[model samples]
Target: MLAWPAWLTILLLVTNLLSLAALFFVTRRMLKLRRQKKRAFAFSDYPVRKAKLEEIAPCFAMSGYGPSPDSEVRFIGGEGVVSSLSDRESWVMAALAKGVKRVFEFGTCSGKTTHVLALNAAPDSEIFTLTLHPDDLAATEFGFGDDREHRDIALSESSFETFYYNGRSSERHIRQIFSDSKSYNEAPLRGSVDLVFVDGAHTRSYVENDTRKALNMLADEGVILWHDYKPGVPGVFAFLNELSRTLPLVHIADTDLVMYRRVRKQLSPA
Candidate 1:
């Protein structure tokens, strides 16, 4: 038996209503990531290179799957559990399978993923990937003509060509995409990317910078996948979870891959 004012009673009701709404939202999202049933890339024998196939066989002997770009990796069968694909390969395949015609990526460590994009594009699709490695930078080359003084020039040119190995395969059809000599934040590909995947600079500051830039450039149908989101990683989870007011997102998590796709578009005046 306590005395309460009429206005105070209304205020309490409003507060409780707000609390319920917040709880509903959080629970809904948690279920979306955890209880999802539609997953891609469970098993496939198709491959880009002979070397890649050989590597996969030995690695996934127990698990039957490899680290993939999105979702938990899949194994062939029989508790195969499979192994993870080399992170670089997983990134490329995920982009292709997502029906992305144009892919924008950050970090070109050894230019592996860039090369992979060059491997999986439709006949005429354009792949615009970027990396910080300078085209004229000095690098080591083996099996070149034995001219020590001229070796540097040959190596630099060869490196450029090798970065696009995906287009050279005889069995598959790939598009020609060269590595752009631009910074990730200042690249010219604004508002024109179909898919954006960020695996470069795992540090918090660098990761945030890449993400901000990627968001601006991501296209209407584009999906953004963040590489290396293990159960224990720090900065990545923060970026995905912050700013719920904007950045409507759905996260898909597995052992090695974590993806956030824009399921619904933000309605703004065109």
Candidate 2:
């Protein structure tokens, strides 16, 4: 081998060092993105009303914005479950369940929310939840309109055959449908649902599809709640951020829940 000039050797070493530094910065940036928290949106602009609970007591009190007087609000404690709502989120669900007769849920993961809905809703209330069955996973397809990563994650998380509500009293009120949410028929339920919980796929495409169906199925003055509206969840964060600009989407402070109320549009005067 030929001897290299000392100057040339030093130049090569410096170039290699610079290259390593660049790589280090890029890697750090990627990891930082993974941990970064997105800014939370405001909660006042949406058509949502807060439920009033007496500061001294845990009981809900009558307020202009509180649940109707006839609503039967109940709480089944959050015990063993894969995933469940926070106390704050539970309060919101229980308060809204009062007097509601029809509820629709997009994802039934562990059925924790379904149990909450059934426990608080009226005795005659009916809940319909849609989730993918493990057997149907082979048939599920991801198209150009869907986010492959989100879809895959959803599939992996949808493998539960048993739910928290199974064998419980609330099971009588829940009608679990084992199928892909995209193919579920929302036509018959149009304008009939009192509350809709959209906790399904976190992908942008799935969120869009579920939101469209929820809007169609909601009755006048109905409410819709979405889960996992955090920043690092790219699909959910991006879709919700853009949708909030067009629609009044309120993010509750400190929780991943976002609320949207459907206001009935009055027809133009004849």
Local distance difference test values of all predictions, in order: 0.48, 0.78
Off by over 4 Å in 1: 1-92, 95-99, 134-187, 243-246, 263-270
**lDDT tens digits, residues 140-213, model 2?**
65557666767778888787899988999999999998877788889999999999999887787778888999
In the range 193-243, model 1's lDDT, one tens digit per residue, is 766767654445556667888878776666676665542344554555463
Number of the top-ranking candidate, with lDDT as the measure:
2
User: Candidate 1: lDDT of 143?
Assistant: 28
The pairs that clash in candidate 2 are none
RMSD of each: 18.8, 9.7
Q: How accurate is candidate 2 locally (lDDT)?
A: 0.78
